[model samples]
Target: MGLIFLGIGIAGTILPVLPGGPFYLVAAFCFTKSSERLDNWFKGTKVYDKYVEGFRQKRGMTRKEKIRINLIADFFIVLSLFIVDILFVQIIMVVLGLYKHYYFIKKIKTIKPGEIE
Candidate 1:
């Protein structure tokens, strides 16, 4: 299960349509519960270490990071919506995508770099 989530997360990182962080986070949590060694390995990973740490420490991303993420998400969302031919569904997706971006930006802005709870 953990590996599955990790794989999905990695794939999501490459594919703009899928979400990455949530998958990685779920994998980490599952690893922590099922195997100490796997948890340790994940914690030691450079690519994922900081994200796990940030979540564990209850820290948030910097303002710049938030802005960058929002911009990227917005770009992908808009691009995908534009390419789709369905008008009503496309409009709904656009609204939902923007809402997701805004939600993350607002949630992440609450924590700055190094400001761990």
Candidate 2:
């Protein structure tokens, strides 16, 4: 299940409709809960290695990067909601999407690429 979320997250990178970072975070959390080995592997992954390092090092994301990522994510989410037109569900998704953005920002603010544990 964690791996599935990770895969979806990766796919989400290309597809504007999917949520990437949240999925990755979910995968990381699930891996930690499910298997130590998998958790280790996830931390070792090249793509996520920086995140793990940053998290351990307590380094923050560059302001520019944060703004760029937030803009892109917000744009996609709004576009998705507009196209989907799910009304109440879309509203909930908007909140969740904003929450995910906040979570990413908070994580990036605290973690630096060089700080992997």
Candidate 3:
């Protein structure tokens, strides 16, 4: 699962359609839970440095990064809204989507580029 997300995240870095940041974070979590060795190995990789390390150190993201992540998340939320028939679930997803934006904008501090390093 970690590797799968890592691959997707790597591809996301290259491809515009996929959002790499969230997937990289997920991969880091999955690796941590799976094994210490795996976690350490992932942290040592350049992918982790490029995607996750800045967020970790600065505790925020650049405006461009935030926008990209939110747009991708919104896309999936809207896609799920069409697929899921349950009104309750749909509502929850909508709330989550809104909250996600709020959290990013309000809760997480937005930093300038090159601020992370």
Candidate 4:
């Protein structure tokens, strides 16, 4: 199960059609619960440094990174509007964006890139 998530995540990172970080983070978490060796191996990867470690350490993305992520999400949401025309669905997407921005602002600690806590 963990490996499946990790594989999808690695593919997602390159594909751009799927959100990679969340899936990878989920995989890391599953590995944490299931296999210490796998978790440590994931920690050693560059992907872990780029996506998960900061949040895991309670130091979140820089504001610029937050903006970048939200913007990308917005872009995908808006694009989906073309294919999924249900008004309720559109509203849900917009709400998801709002919640994401709120999460970044209120929950995650803003950090400077490359600054270790």
Off by over 4 Å in 3: 1-36, 45-47, 114-116
lDDT by residue for model 4 (1-117), tens: 679988888876654245567788899889899989988898898988888886677557788888887677767767877778799977776776676667768876788877867
Candidate 3 per-residue C-alpha lDDT over 1-117 given as tens digits, one digit per residue, 9 for 90 to 100: 999999998886654335577789999999999999999999999989877988888888889988987887787778878888999988888887787777778987899887635
Q: Judged by lDDT, which candidate is best?
A: 3
Q: Tell me, by TM-score, which candidate is best.
A: 1
Question: What lDDT is obtained when candidate 4 is compared to the true structure?
Answer: 0.76
Ten residues in a row with the worst lDDT in model 1? 107-116
> Number of clashing residue pairs in every model?
0, 6, 0, 0
C-alpha lDDT of all candidate models, in order: 0.73, 0.70, 0.83, 0.76
Please state the error at residue 84 of candidate 3 in Å.
0.7
lDDT of 1 by residue, 52-73 (tens): 5665567566776667756776
1-117 in candidate 2: lDDT tens per residue? 889988887887656545566677778888999999999999889757644344344445656556766778778778888788779868876887777677766655643445453
TM-score of 2: 0.54
Better of 3 and 4 by TM-score: 4
